[model samples]
Structure formats: structure tokens, C-alpha cells
Target: MACRVLEYLILPLVGAKTLIVGAKSVNYMKKNASTALRVRWSGSIRGGYSSNHGSRFYFTFDRAPCTGPAGIEAVDWTGASRNYHQHIEFEGLCNNIPAGHMQIGFNVGTLPGISWQPYLGWTTSGKPKITAEEVDLGENKGMCPHHTVFNVKQHTLATADTDSGIYGASAFRYTKLAPDTSLRVRWFGALGAKSQSPAPGCLRFYFTFNGEECKSPTPIDGAIAWLTDPIIQTRTTHSSQGDYAVALNVGQCLFGNLNQMDPDPHVNDVSRIIVEEVRLGKSQFAEQAVLLTCSFESSSICGFTQSTNDDFNWTRRSGGTSSSYTGPSSAYSGSYYMYIETSSPRVLGDTAVLYTPNLNLAGGCGRLVFRYHAYGSSLGYLRVKLYNGQHMTQQLWAYSGYSKNTWQETNVYFKQGGNFQIAFEGVRGRGVTGDIAIDAVAVFNVSSSYCNSPNRDLPKAAQQVFNLRHWNWYNLNFTGLGEIKSMIYPKISSTSGLRVSMTATVMTSQRLGPCTQWQFRFGGHVCPVPTHSVEGSRYTYSYQTTTQHLFPITVSGICTGLPAENLVLSIHTSSCGGSPAVDAVTGWQTSFFVSAEEVVLP
Candidate 1:
């Protein structure tokens, strides 16, 4: 049982314990004695995850507060469709959680793309695993300051795993911490909630704070790492500053709140108190952890706590004025998703727009960020313009000329002075040559992309090539589109130059003009475009690249055009056959290699 202690009433005398009342928690620990006393309520990311994703949906334990929780665990996943899934054990303004809805996300990887597969539904009857809801725990209250919850996360990869290669992780899920807060710890449960009597074996893991401070290289001198399980994971012990690095764990703490005590939805953290995910395989093993956190000095009558929420707003913004987004897929009830026909080449000013709900900008600032793809040609462009939707106002941050179909990201921020309209505008080939796909769009009042995903890993391109050396391309019949799908690579590096290894598939000695382009950038300079050729169905290409910061890659440009005979003309860009300015073309290729170091150059 992953539990984040919401409120802790420490008394010098240990006779009485506190009790959960309707909207508040009573500290009876002092009963008739008269001494100093303290109580707290907090919550945190439990059960589900502490990161961002596009596949599995997330739920909120509903308790991320400095108050206490007052509910048991056990919920209904039905009716969760379209809106808040029943009464979540969460805190509201009056509860421990910070006002409205607060969340602490997590990442726990899983099968790349298996959830879509068919599954047989079943209804096996067994005794209630945990305690059932006695009543609507925190019914009439907005927040609960008397509940305890522990968040557990399970993450998954987006792209399907069809190839066999070591693909660097594109996501992070495990013990995550709020950047500003370092006093918290993460804990996991080895077994499901066995008996509430505190399972002795539950604490097999250890959370070594400041584990990144080892002067000598030793097994125990690194950042907080874990006992590698089905979820193969090492340790990364450094953040932006070298002071200390963050690590995952099996122990973490959270506070319970009064408003978040509704047992109906099974406080979002309850189910995730233990989780499993797919690191390289289909999912990480089921996980269980207890969270430990400290109390904050808020008002005299209250202490501090964490939140256990996983409610994200991937909700496609509306065509007009829109705000909050709910679950069950589809954008919010009032918004619309604009899918550009970028499916092909077109110059239609396609844009995706959304507005933040009327936030109290009078107090703080608002920001927006989202994932992007397709970064190569200077001709391909996506100008993300944030309109002040308030009309006459200025837009937020904007980026352009990223690429064609590669995946990447961009950010925009706005001050409290004006409202804004965030837009991803693609002027591809002047808005007519390629495609761009966007996911996980968000606007945070406090943090930026961080809120969109807590334990999220910045994405990296999975490079690969179809070269003759890897396979024989002559037997094209052996490998078709279906087989190509299985050729997905996590990464492909070549000292002699990477190329499509389709030997087992086909070989077309009958020179067929081959044409295709991968997205690339030159860090304000030009890149040594790689070269490729068709020796049958197997395409081969190679080139060396200069180290640069321009690798914010998006998608591999998938190009198909003209007739079979035209293949001859497609190989050489110098084969320029069109007019001067209108159809001007250049016969150039680029080559790239992973830089020796993944660090900012001095």
C-alpha cells in the first residue's frame, strides 16, 4: 500500500490518536493534556505514474495537499468516462491539497502498443481485496485533510517495438521528485496490499538521500539506483547543477486530506500504490511503494504536504474560448481538434489553437508547450504563434522551420499581463510539402513542460537505415510494408555509414531511381547530407557529420512520387528538371553520428 502521509499530529504524550471528522481532522492525541502539538495533511502521485504519455490514460488519487485524508481504498473504473471518475480521494482548497486540483505524476513504462490488442473481459468473483467504501468519505467537502495515500506510476513507450536494437529510453518513470523539494523519498511495495498490519517485507528497498555525493567510483557511491528488476534501470545522479541528482525509490510519503476522502473512485493513488511497467519488454513488473514527505510551514493552523494526482490536459484546445479538459478521450466538451491535411502536401494555413481557462493571471504567469516533429529542410516550416485570444494582445513563444515529419518539441510563455492563443502553424514547403503531428499540449500556471510530465524523458530520434550490408534487398518480395514495420529500430549508428540492410528481402539490380529523405538540421550551418543508392530493393547510404546542437529531430520524411522510370531522376538532386525559382532543386545529402558526449559544449 503506497501511502503519502497527509497529516501527522506529533504529541509528546502518546495516549490518544487523531480521528477523521467530516471536513477536518481532530488531533485527540493531546486529549486532556496541555502541550505544543502539530498535525499535517499531504498527498502525492501514486499508483499510476509521475510522467507524461499518449497511450495509457492517468487518474488522480485526488490527494496532493498539506492536509489529511479521510477515506479507504477501493474504487470503480466504470462511469469514469467523460468526467471526474467518481469521488476521488483528493484534497481541495479546504483539504490538504493546494486549492483546486493538484497532481504529482510518475512514469512506469509498459508494452509499446499492446493495449490496443484484443482482450477477453471477465468477472471473477473474489473477496473484496481491500476495504470497500463505508460511505462517501468526504462527500460534502471540497478537500479532505485526514487521508493518507501513496502514488505509484506505470509508464509506457509510444512507438511500437518492431525492430531489435537498444533504443535509448524516451521516457522516465520511477521515484520522481519536485525539483525544488529535496526532502522527499520514494518507496515501493513488493507485494500487493497484503494485510494492513504493515507487511514486513515491504521495505526491501532503500532510499539513500544525496547518494550522488560519492567522491570515489563505487557501487554504492552513485545516485539512488534500484535493485534492477523486470524494469531494467540504472541510475542517473546529476541534475542541471552537479549538487545532487534525483533517483527513483520504493519509499515516498504523502499527506491525506479531508476533501479527498471519497472512497468511491479509490483515491487515485490506491490502485497505483503498486504498479508495473515495460522498460524494454511489454511492461514493468507490478510495483508497490510507500512515499515519505516532510511538513511545510504554511499557516499556523496548517502544515504542508504533496499531491497524488495524474490529471493532465492533452485535451485538444477549442476552436474558440475554452478551458478545462476531462478524460474518456476526445478534447474538452467545448474544444475542437484541427487535423491538417498535412497527410499530403498542401498550402492551407492549418493551425491548432487553444486557450487557457480564465486563470488568475493577476497573480502569476501562464505557459504552454507541446511535442513537434519533422525537422530538416529550410522550406519546411511550422510557425507556432500564440495569439492573445484576447485579441489585440500579443502571442506567446513561437518557433519555425523545424522540419517535415520528424518529431520534436517547442515552448511558449506568457506573462500575467495578457491572455494568449497558442498555435502550431506549419508553412510546410510554404505549407504544401510535408506533415507534422502534435501531442501532449499543455499550459501550466506554475511550471512548463514539467507539469505536462513529471518523470518524463526528453525524446530522442531512433535512427536506422535500409542498407545492403545489413540485408539483401534484391528479393524485394521477401520484405514488404508489413515486414518493414517489423524493422523499426531503436537506433542505428554506422562508422562506415548506415544504410538499409534489406538483403533477405529483395535486390533490384535493374537500377530503379531511388528517392527518400530523412529529417536533419545544421545548427545554423549546413550538414554533410548522407548519400543513398538502390542496388535492388536494398537502399544504401552513408556520410560523416559535424557535432552540433541542431539534432532536435522530429520525423523521417517519407517521400513517394513520380513514375518508376522517374526513379532515375530522383537519385540526383542536381538532376534539376524544373524552372529556376519556382521548382529549383539542389542535389545534396547529409550524414550524422551521435556526438561523443551528450552535454552542452563550452
Candidate 2:
């Protein structure tokens, strides 16, 4: 049996030893004095046997606040102490055990304001073959402050063993300070050796403050280094030592807050709470805000001007350039882009420069994002430069050569600490068969992580190769002419909330192309139809007989570890006006095969 002091109360004395009520006063250490002074105590003190381990019995206690009831003057009470005891009947617990030696251990903790000097002494009813360790009564010592650093070596297993790799939860008391004070937490961890998938395991950090769960604003997600892939199948017995950096943000603290790690399943182990630094001053990398935006789709250049000192001016045109095999077939997003033609008075090595309006970046670092199109065999070079003050000029980004003949996007990070502007300089290539264009320019006051991250708003490409692959084959058979039939097939399995994309192939004996309609649904979210018309409930498309048709389908809302539920793909065929049906005399057959790609949600 065991007992612990679960709560305490402060004793605020008026005089040397007197606690005065409204009309009565009590003095302690008196012969016949009535007990009138009281100290309030609360919270639970209970014991129970372990559910899984029959040999273990434990007790839990929570720290409660200390306060006086009423009718007492305020006293300079720095701390309080409590004590209790328990008696155990050991014969009943050892009835089924063989005659052998047993060991017992206990853990203890002190309250935030109080220091405890514990003296644990025990006595046995009869000193038989069993023995116990002698308890030591030591001197009282000061306890550590509220912000105690933890030094632990905890391990986490992959999802193959459990659903999630959550280590545990804990809280700490905080010294009250000003609002918006940054509480920075740093951690170092390592992954297992056998992690050989496209998505490796990493640590995740989260904290609760002011009654709300918060994550770091800089990392986009609280996941360290994009722990976006969670499918781990194989494992190794050993682990290698490596350093992994992670952080958490505790917005504003009042008294104390809770924090924990929800690490990826494949994470091997975490070392310690390495650092917990609190910065009370303003930081250089604050929150982000948009500074400027331009799409280059209007008659105006959005406060941009042509440099008179350059060789030529940039021309705003819609669609492709007049010269063939030299420019983009169409604008990247809209109807127009700023480009330069090299057919007229412009010769080889001619340069074109465009300048943005002066911007005040004295606050902090900024991110510049834009899209560029450099097609054709003789592609010129595009350089992005930063012009600051009267003479400081630095090239931020530059690209040359033909890059897949498609529109590509990039971003640059710069900090001038003063007034500045941006310049987009283009140099013509060997011949007039070169045209370079730029579009969708924008700037924002943000950290470098924003510029380094991929564009999240764009749709991810449908993939065919990944870990934990799933696929199946379905058939839709038809018979007789002018037959209108429909079928609904639920095709899904437990995906554990990973990002999934589906691709399908349909093989038919006869062409029912213009008369077929199909749709795929995951729970309440519907995947976009692959046909040309996206405005209808079900899209219609055509196909060729004896040929294979490929459909790329993207399913949304399967992220965040939510299971893909009630996934159904429906198809129907309608009678086309005056169109011949598929093999009226003999039955026609159609086979459908579907495969998927799964990855961790970003």
C-alpha cells in the first residue's frame, strides 16, 4: 500500500500564531484552545491495479491549488507541506506466486512552490524470508523552478505496430510575462536505419496555450521536413544516430501550457528537450503579409515601367507570338503576358529591362514569386535583379536554355532594409527565333521557408508509382441494341488518410464513346470528371472499340488520416440519336482496370 500528499493549503496567520475570525480568534499550542483555524484541501487520492500487468498496483495524484477559506489576514506564506501514510495486506497479493524474492519501486514529485524532504520508512509484520530495502531520510532541498528541462530517451514505433506514434503529453508552469513573447522550443531526434521509401519518417510538434492548440507558423505544417509519407512496411532491429531539428510555438502564456509530439510512425527515437529559449524582444522573422500583386492581364502594366536606358521595350501580347516556334502557344493562366520580340530593329545580344515601382522593404525580408515561359530552340536568358538605394544592385535569380518548353515558376528571397525596386532583364539569343516572357509577379513580407515551399494551391499531378499500392479490375458487360444500363461499384479499402489518386483503363468491344457518362465519389467529395465538360453532374465522353482509353482521376479529402469511405464509381450509357448499338446479335464485353498512387498529405 502507498499514500501521497495530493494537495496543500497556505496558513495565513494574523499574529504570531493566531488566526482571527469575525468575532472569534484561535491561538495554537494552547492547552484547552478549541480548533478554529482550518486549511482547505481538495483533489483525488486513489489506487488501482494495472489492467495489463497483474503484479503491479499504482496510485495517481494531481496537484491542486492552496487557498484560505475566509476571515484571515494576508500572510507572507512562501510554501506549504503535507504528509500521509498507508498500510498494505501483502498476504493476499502473493497467494499464487512461488516462493521467491520481489522488488518494489516508487516515483515522487514536488509541487511548484513547495520543497519536500521525504523520509520513507516501512515496517513488516514478521521478518521472514522476504526482505525490503532500507529507506533514507535526507535533508530538505529546494526544488527546480517551473521551467524544468526534461532529459529523456523515448522511442516510437511504425504504424505497422500501432495507428499513430504519439509519445505522450506533459505540461509546465510558466513565469508570467508580457504578451506576444515568443517561447521557442528546440528538439533533436533520429530515424531508423531501414527507412527506404520515398517518404521518410520525422517528428511532429504541437502545443496548447490560452485554451487552444497552436503550431509553428514558419514550417507551414508542424511536421518536421515534410513527414508527409506514412506508409512503412518493413523494419530493422537497430537504429543509427542522426540529428533532426524541430520547433514549436507557444503564442502567449498565462500560467502554464501543455505540449506533446505526434511523431510519424517510422520515427525511431527522440533524444531530449535540448533547448527551450524564450525571446522577450521583437523578432526579425515575424508573421507574413502580401505586399504587391500583379497578373499582367490588363491594359496597364501594374505600376511597371520600361527602362529608357535599355535597348528595347517589352510588348504585351495575347496568345502566341507572330514568329513561329519561338514563344509560348498561350498565356500561362490568363490572356496576356509581357514579352519581347526579336524580329525588328532588335539584333542579337539586345537587352530589354522592365522596372517595378519603388517599394519600401525596411521592415524585413520579402519573397518575390513569378512565372516565366522560355520555349523555342534559341531561348534567351532571363535575369531577376534587386535594385536598392542609389547604387546597390544584386542579381537574385537567373535562368537560361530551353526548359521543357513549358511555363515554370520560381521565387527569390531578398532583404534590402531600405527603399528598393525589382528589375526583369532579358537578353536576346543567337537569332530572332527567341522569345522570353514573364507573368504573375507578386511580392510578400514573409520568411525564406515560404519561398522554398512548393505552390500548395496548384493540383498535384496524378502518379502511378508509390508505396502501398492498391488496384483491382472491374467489368461492365452489355447485350442487345439500344440498351440503356447503369452500374454502381464501390471500390475502396482502408488507406489510412494518405493522399490518393486513381487512374483507370477501359477496354471495349464496340465504340460507345459519345454515349457513356461516368463519375467517382469519395464520401461526400466528388472527383472531377475527365471529360471536356465540367459543368454537368456526370460528364459524357467518346471511345474507340478494340482500343484502350486512359482516364486520370484525382480524389480529394482523403488526407489528414481520414479513411476513404463509401468510394463509388458510377457509369451509364444513353442512346445516341440514330446511332448503332453495340453488337445487338451477340453480347459485347467491356473490361475496366483501376490503379492508384498514395502519399502523405502536405
**lDDT leader:** 2
The Cα local distance difference test for each model comes to: 0.21, 0.35
After TM-score superposition, the amount by which residue 557's alpha carbon in candidate 2 deviates from its true location, in angstroms, is 6.1
Model 2 clashing-pair count: 3
Model 1 TM-score on a 0 to 1 scale: 0.22
lDDT of candidate 1 at residue 207, scale 0 to 100: 23
Off by over 4 Å in 1: 1-339, 342-362, 375-380, 389-392, 447-602
| Highest-scoring model, TM-score | 2
Model 2 poorest ten-residue lDDT run: 1-10
Write the residue-wise lDDT of candidate 1 on 1-602 in tens digits. Answer: 11121111211212112211121222222211111111111111112111111111121233322222322221112211111000011111112332222222211222242221111101110000100000111221221111111122322222212111111122243343222111212111111111112211111111232443211111111010110011111111221211232232322111111111111111122211112111121111100110111111112101111112211112222232121121112211112332223323234443333232333433235444455444333234445543444343553444555443433445444454444334444443443334343443444443233224333321111001111111111111221111121222211111112212110101111122221122222221112231212111111111211110000010111111110110111111111111111111111011111111010000
Which regions of candidate 2 fall more than 4 Å away from where they truly are?
1-287, 389-392, 448-602
Q: Report the C-alpha lDDT of model 2 over 1-602, residue by residue, as the tens digit.
A: 00000111112122111111121211222111111111111111111111111011111111211121111111111111111111111100111111222222122233233333321111111110111111111111121111111111111211122223222322333332222223333222221112213432233233333323433322111222211121111100111122222222212112123122233323222122212222221122322455566667678778988988889999898889988878777776457888888776778789999988788764557767777888777767888998875454789999888656677777567766667888999998877778898877776565443334365221111111122223322223334333222222222212222323221211111344322222223343333322111111111122323322211111111222222222333322233322343432111111122222233221
